[model samples]
Target: MFAVDTSPRSRTRQYSTSSSSSTRSMAQRDSMDIDSAALLDIQRALDIARNTEGDLDHSVEKYLEEQLTGVWNRLESRPNTYVLSKDEFAIFNYFVGRYQDSKVAEKAIARFWSSYQDTGSS
Candidate 1:
């Protein structure tokens, strides 16, 4: 004669393993989703900038004339506008340090932008 026995032990073990694996899978998926979303946002911002003719060298003069003027005007109007953040300061310093001439800096920034896209697309 043979007897079959059923116990909670088997079910508990199975449940634990499944739950742990599910959690791991969910975490992995979440990470991947976040990465994809970030990439999409960056792509969208670049597209808008590109569409707006924000190329560094080609549009530098216009950008400087328009955007900078707008920014200055806003700051002047606001009076209490926040000072340049760290990143803004860094960018300003980089341009100032890299090229003595504003024209040269404009050209270099444009070239850098073009090269960045070229390398990234590949």
Candidate 2:
């Protein structure tokens, strides 16, 4: 649901592939290409923060303003998803702005939902 185009959603800096029939003595290794959604988020974040002074949360907020609704729509559709947490805003800002990768942010949110367990303390 996060991917708006026909592209991947996430990627890592490094990846490895085993070589069973390679002439080289080492395995093949390369950097994974980032998805278009993440790339777009990066570009948009940069554009938003270009003239802003200090406080990256604002830029993140702007980015979220454009994408949060879509994400929430998906989350709201599923039962037992999107638990209310105290760190919600902080988590949102970090994922949405830290690396300017919304695709990862989306994935992170989904992950949090599945892994979240209420301790019944707060």
Task: Note each model's CA RMSD in angstroms.
Answer: 25.4, 14.7
User: TM-scores across all candidates?
Assistant: 0.23, 0.27
lDDT of 1 by residue, 1-122 (tens): 11112323221100001122343333233323343223222222223333442222222223333433333343344333323322222333333553455553444345445654665798
lDDT of each: 0.33, 0.38
Best by lDDT: 2
Which residue pairs overlap in candidate 1's backbone?
none
Q: Give the backbone clash total of model 2.
A: 0
Worst ten in a row by lDDT for model 2: 25-34
Candidate 1 contains a number of clashing pairs equal to 0
For all candidates, the clash counts are: 0, 0
CA lDDT, candidate 2, residue 59 = 28
After superposing candidate 2 on the true structure, give the runs of residues whose Cα lies further than 4 Å from its correct spot: 1-39, 42-51, 54-63, 82-91, 94-122
